[model samples]
Target: MKEFVWAVSIICILLVFGVVLLKYLSENKKYKNSSYGKQSQKSFWKIISNQGARGEYRTSQIIDKAPFKNKMLFNCYIPNRSGDKTEIDMIMLCQKGIYVIENKNYSGWIFGNEKSKNWCETLKGKKYFFYNPIKQNRTTV
Candidate 1:
C-alpha cells in the first residue's frame, strides 16, 4: 500500500511539472521560437481564422500571374453607421463591374448550400461550422 501511494504521488508531481513546463514554454515566446516551433509558425488552433489569409495569399498568387488590366483591391474595410467595420477580401474592378470574392479555406468534407445560414465542415472525426461566405460578402456590395 505504501509503495502504491509513493508511486501515485510521484506520478502526480511529474504531471504537475510537465504542465508547468508547457505553460512556461508557451508563455515565453523566445523558448518556443528557439525550439522547433514549426506548429507555432502556423495559426492558433490551425482552424479557419488565419486560413482565410492563407487562402487569399494563394489566390493572390494565381491572380497576380494572370495578365489583365483589371484592378484587384485587397482587404477593403468599410465603416458602418454603428462605427463598426465590414471587411471585404478581394474586389476586382473589370470592364463588366465590381466582382466581390470571398474565400473559405476549409478542409475535409464541406456540407452546406449557398442559401444555408451556416456551412459545416467535417475534419479529423470532428465537425466545424462557419458562416456562409456568399451571404457574408453580399454586404460588401
Candidate 2:
C-alpha cells in the first residue's frame, strides 16, 4: 500500500508539472505573435519569470492602447563612456519628445526618495531593498 501511494504521488507531481509546462508554452507562443513581444528582445522565459520583464511587457500593453501615435522600443541597450551598456526598459517616441521609462513591479509598501540610492519594499513583515528606478533611468538617459 505504501509503495502504491508513493507511485501515485509521483504521478500526480508529474501531471501538475506537465500542466504548468503546457500553459507556459501556450503563453509564450501568444506573446511571440504580439507586437510587444516582437519589439522586445527579452526571451520568453525572462518575460514569464522575471518581475521586471513582466512589468515592462505590461507597460508596453498600456502604451499600445494609448490614442496618441507613438513608436516604442523595448529592452534597448546603449553604450556608455565606461565601455559598459545601460539598459532602458522602454522608450516612447512621439511628436512631443522621447520619453524613457523604467519599469518596476513591486508589491506592498515602497519607501524611497529621488536622492536615495536604494528603495525599501515592505512586504508582510519583511523589508527588501532595491536600486532606485529614478537613478537607474537617469544614468540611462
Candidate 3:
C-alpha cells in the first residue's frame, strides 16, 4: 500500500540521519580530545567545514610547536575606521613584538601584487578572486 511504502521510506531516512549524526559526534569528540583541538578551541565540524577556520587551526598548531614562548590569539575582532569590526585570523605576542597574522588557505597558482586590491587563484582551469592579504593586514593593523 502507498501509506505503508511512505512509512518505510520515512523510517529509512531517519535511520540514515541518525547514523550520520552519531558518526559526526564520535569524530567531534575525538578531535576535541586532541591537543591541537584544545588549543584551537573549535569544534571538529567547524574546523573541517570552514576553510578559513581550518587554516587558522593549522596555524595555531604550528605556533604551538614553535621553539619559543609566545601568546597566541585566534578569531580576534577589532574595530576599524568605519566603526565595523574586522576579524583577524590570529595574533602572536612574543619578545620581539606583536604580530598579526592573516592566513590564506588557497590551493592553486596565486597571482597578485602587494598594491593590488584583490588577488586571483587559478585552479583546475578556473579562476577565483579574493581580497589581497597585504591590504587586509594593513587595514587590521
Candidate 4:
C-alpha cells in the first residue's frame, strides 16, 4: 500500500509538470510568432469577413473591365432610413438600373429557392439556415 501511494504521487507530480511545460511552450511559440507576423495578415475570423468584401470588390472590378461606357459605383453598407435601419451590402449603378447586391461568403452546399424565405447550407455536414438575400435587399430598396 505504501509503494502504491508513492507511485501515484509521483505520477501526479509528473502530470502536473507536463501540463505546465506544455502551456509554457505554447505561450512561448505564440509570443515568438507574434513578433514575426505582419499586422496586415488577417486572422481566421477576419478572413471570413473579408471574403464577402473581396467578392463585392471583385464584382465591381469585373464590371469595370467590360466595354460599358456608363458610370459604375460600388457602395458598401449603405444605411436605410427604414425603422429597422437595415444596411445594403453593395450597390452597383449601371446603364440599366441600380443593382443591390448582398454578398454572402459561406462555404457549404447551399439549398433553397429564390421564393423561399430562408435557405439552408450544409457546411462540413453541419446545417445552417440564413434569410434570403433577395428579400433582404428588397426590404432595403
lDDT of 1 by residue, 26-129 (tens): 74453233211222344423322466765765565576556765667767788755678988777778777888888777899998888999989999999999
Candidate that would win on TM-score: 2
Candidate 3 segments exceeding 4 Å error = 1-36, 39-41
Worst 10 residues of 1 by lDDT: 31-40
Q: Evaluate model 3: give its TM-score.
A: 0.72
Cα lDDT tens digits for candidate 4, 50-84: 67654654454465566765444334344465655
Regarding lDDT, does 1 or 4 come out ahead?
A: 1
- Model 3 error, position 103 (Å): 0.9
Q: What overall lDDT goes with each candidate model?
A: 0.69, 0.87, 0.85, 0.63
Off by over 4 Å in 1: 1-50, 80-83
Give TM-scores for every candidate, taking all chains together and pairing residue i with residue i: 0.59, 0.74, 0.72, 0.54
> lDDT of candidate 2 vs native?
0.87
- Residue 39, candidate 4: Cα error in Å is 22
lDDT of 4: 0.63
Clashing pairs in 1: none
Query: What is the C-alpha lDDT profile of model 3 across 84-133, one tens digit per residue?
Result: 99998878999989999999989889999999999999999999999999
The all-Cα superposition gives candidate 3 an RMSD in Å to the true structure of: 5.5
lDDT of 2 by residue, 32-83 (tens): 8766799777789888798878877777878888899999888789986677
